[model samples]
Target: MPQRTVDTVIFDLGGVIMSNGKPSDFASRFPEADRERVIEIIMGPYGQDSDHPWHRVERGEITMEECRSLNRDAIIESGIMPILSTMQPQGQESSSTGGISFNFSLSEPMVQLIHELRDNDFRIGVLTNNVREFREWWWPLMDFETVFDTVVDSSEVGLRKPNPAIYHLTMDRLGATPSRTAFLDDLQSNVDAASALGMHGIRVDDDPSAAIAQTRLLVQL
Candidate 1:
């Protein structure tokens, strides 16, 4: 494959190469009876904003109890019955499992592509807007040191996407100059932020196949 100008590729973990299609897609997996309500509770007007429980969870500032409280409040404010069935407690000391559990299953194709990139001498890294406790769920599934040259978890650094500082941190850690790095993210704002820093930026869409195609096109792989 012909090379693009970028020397390093930075991917957002959730939807770029992982099997998570979209955050809202999970609502469809619930029982039909709970579908509408769950979607409204997790992906509706309150769902998209930064003040939501999920947002706070991703940021790692709030405890699990605080997340549930926020979730309950979001549901009630949306005129729906509150259900804490999917809320999981935060912190290692807690033994509750009422909140959503995040799972990141890498597609075989993505895994192969990553391996190929490394074999071809490309530097790879991950910059995700993940919870502080993300390693509790991800470490067992993937090799951070082997699969990625560097990882900048937003929660660990206290800087989330659309914030240029986070992206700058990633570039610094990866030793990649902005002109030599390409960033892929599920959100347009995140991509735009990367672009502002002089990196090639690609927005991942809902379809995994489409996202993969976009990645290949951008990388010229």
Candidate 2:
């Protein structure tokens, strides 16, 4: 079968391109119900919504330093620290900002995959719910100019994943419509949001191979 032709491809940054120490990743640290409870506190209302402080940090509404301080204080005040204590790895240090350390790293073949797409003349764009502080560390790791046509960071734009507005902002900036662009994210909720808005949404979990495979199938790359 002839490959479907796509001009624009949007990639999610965190889980898709890099790893982050997410609270959910420590589920084994707590007992079943306890882990669920901790996760609920961490995510809060509107899970991953702009209203969340973590989202605020992503939008540049607060500095990472401040966020860390606030999160620790809140956890302490709320008595969440005791539970988290059990989850903390021995000798493992939490981020100075009082959260798990999450930095962007180029996932091996995923980097190659992006290059392959670019080499094939696919216009690539990045859409990420990222903090402003990330740019200080993330850019030096990879040559983004060589890889993507545009990037929309939530901290820079004040919009985030699962929000229809943020996706529209990216598509408009990339000058792409939903059908013409393929969107890959590590979260189903985000993929669903993109799909709802007409983008070809490919959902994956932490693994970029799923995204790579889906992209190949979608565009016959």
Candidate 3:
């Protein structure tokens, strides 16, 4: 067999390995008219890591409760709180905490692909911009230790995607060179960041088939 150009594969968790629960997924649940604004307030600018409440939470600088308080204040100030309140179900009580919940399921095809890559001796890792509070809920969805060589969670590491430091850190953990690593993420900005750093970055869409195909090509699998 010819030499493979890529030996390490890095994945973003929420939209790539997990079927749902991305920030966009949460925004999608809101009415179309309010979706974009809701996403902006709840997730901030995803392409850049700043002191936004959500970003701070992901970096472990703030607890989820504090993030929720900040979100509530922002929402109230935006005057959208009343609109959101009116959208609640007639019988259901509104939650005072401006918190978002995520329910995610493993992406079977991605899981299978990971196992195949492992069998082929390619290193696998996860680099996710995630909340500390969400670990318990999403951790059990996969046999992470058995599949991935390393799992880098932003909250635990105090860094998130689009911040070049985290990507460098992940590659360092895997003992991987940027040119020999393939990174897959559902967000274009994250993918672009990795690509800018000389990693072969693949953008995953709602349907992951294209991204998987691209990755296979990159590693010559």
Candidate 4:
């Protein structure tokens, strides 16, 4: 492990430290879909100031229940649902996905790594674009009190990632600065957001061991 002058480590929840718990079938709905296309159609393109239903849910302006209903209506009314319905939902893919996966389980390796970081005095935090019902399912993954010093969930904060405000808020909660924090996420766009603000953005996807190694490299006691 290589040591750096980092005081805090911020991680995204869904794909980084957790097995992205999306219904395996939902992902296979569009086998040939490109990442960009999936975002554009599923929840509008990535960026701040989105009126997309997912954004609204993350912002706490709408509930996840409402977002799902709205999504189905829009897809059906726009004739997108007919096309989607024809495709059979297959097994899940291991590649990067720009959307949120509601089904998540804790990764033991990640949990151990986090505990080690915490024990070493590195402030640990989680910045996730999660739904309102997140605690119900995610709490069992790890003991939040022992592992995380702060957690900024989009649904409660009315802010989401790739947006500058959320990043600032997270750093503020951890009492760290942009340069002193190391951020990790599965999405390039979210990583870019953190990088733009001077945080070390470590990207992880598909392969957990490689991702963990990358994190350990930057985080040495």
Candidate 5:
């Protein structure tokens, strides 16, 4: 076990604190045809292309409407005209109770751990890489300002994780030093980035309860 030098703790929202109710979760919202079409689109050229509109959506450069238009165009280019009506309905799912809902409500153990950390006077932050369109729903659930001393969203900052600048921005915003911070992320790439920056990075994954226990042990909390 690593010795505790952790003065700050940073968490990633999606897949860490909350689930990413993305295409899979939204699938039931659409008609069978639309769902099949969407699956095809995701598994085809659009998925292969880094410059796909989905990337634009992820980077916050495009609005949902713009992305939808772009996706519709992509489908057309693929020699299929996607039924926009079906797609529209899928996008109408409520933000609050969608597939992306936080599971922590059922994981009381994790919730208590979070409260314990806060009570122990640790500085905490929430950093997430997310599409801007879902902010209205996701942000309120995370309650960044209430649970964390600082919040870093890639959509708002234009720099996503695995990117050192985003990490620097978080540090700068919180006036924290990398050496004193412990970063938790479900992604190894993000964890590696934080570790490279001289921060303690814990990869939180399946059996996150064990991971959390390990984390508490790491920081000697």
Candidate 6:
């Protein structure tokens, strides 16, 4: 197949355009708990769309409160609740009953890049596996309506990342084909999925400069 020039760029919300809020990032809050185990119980195999409470919440199949209840129960049963309790009191301001905060900040660098892409006429879109309740928290971070051609929230659409359908949906909404699109995500699995569909996938790390540079190169900005 002939090469296609990139015209569309898709971004993942958390850890990409926004500061980190992944399971690992949350796990770090509980220094007393096993980080890997904490991440597993909280996120429940994020690389795949499963019946895990976290995944269900992301798909809008269940409410965040319900998922939190479920996760709390699991933590209690696993004997980690006590450790978490020592960190913070119950009913405190937290993303979950486990007291892990979901607080995140917008990445100014990524925001600037989005503006640059828009100025250069590249179609921009956001595909995020986000919670419905947390929409209010992230929406105000950016003028999304003006910046993005489309914003596909997993909670709104019942599909999440690493699931090929969502990628196709974003591409369809952007009126861009896979070969002519570039996707940036913090998760390697998500990036790999986009690459599998023929889109240029760029993984954003702690320092987004590398991913930003890669994206500019791919789109020849």
Model 3, range 45-110, lDDT digits (tens) per residue?
A: 988999999999999899888888788877767665433433234555423223333457888888
Which sections of candidate 1 miss by over 4 Å? 1-4, 26-53, 81-99
Worst lDDT run of 10 residues, candidate 1, spans 85-94
lDDT string for model 2 (80-198, tens) is 54435443446665464354433446677677878888898888899987777657556777877667888899889988888899999998988888888999887777898999998
Which one is best on TM-score? 3
* Candidate 2 collision pairs: 68-97
Q: Which 10-residue window in model 5 sums to the lowest lDDT?
A: 97-106
Name the regions of candidate 3 deviating beyond 4 angstroms. 81-101
lDDT of 4 at 169: 98
lDDT of 6 by residue, 72-164 (tens): 888877776433433343665655433443456888999999999999888999999998877756788778999999999999999998999
Candidate 5 deviant stretches above 4 angstroms:
1-4, 19-52, 71-108
Q: Per-residue lDDT for 213 in model 5?
A: 85
- Model 2 superposed RMSD (Cα): 3.9
Full ranking by TM-score: 3, 6, 4, 2, 1, 5
In candidate 4 the C-alpha lDDT for residue 23 amounts to 22
Candidate 2 lDDT for residue 165? 94
Q: lDDT per residue, candidate 5, 1-221, as tens digits?
A: 44557778888876566644334434443445466566556423322224566655655777656666677766666565333333234435544322232222223455566778889888888887666766765665545678788878877877676778888999888788999888887767678889999988998774578768877886788
Whole-model lDDT values for every prediction: 0.69, 0.72, 0.85, 0.73, 0.66, 0.85
lDDT of 4 at 221: 44
lDDT of model 2 at residue 136?
57
lDDT of 1 by residue, 1-111 (tens): 554676798988877767673554455444443665776576443223366666666667775556666677666676554333233345423333244555556666666
Q: Output the better candidate (3/4) by lDDT.
A: 3
| Every candidate's CA RMSD | 4.5, 3.9, 3.6, 6.0, 5.8, 3.6
User: Better model by TM-score, 2 or 3?
Assistant: 3
- The regions of model 2 sitting more than 4 angstroms off are 1-4, 21-36, 43-48, 82-103
Specify the poorest-scoring 10-residue window by lDDT in model 2. 21-30
* Worst 10-residue lDDT window, candidate 4: 93-102
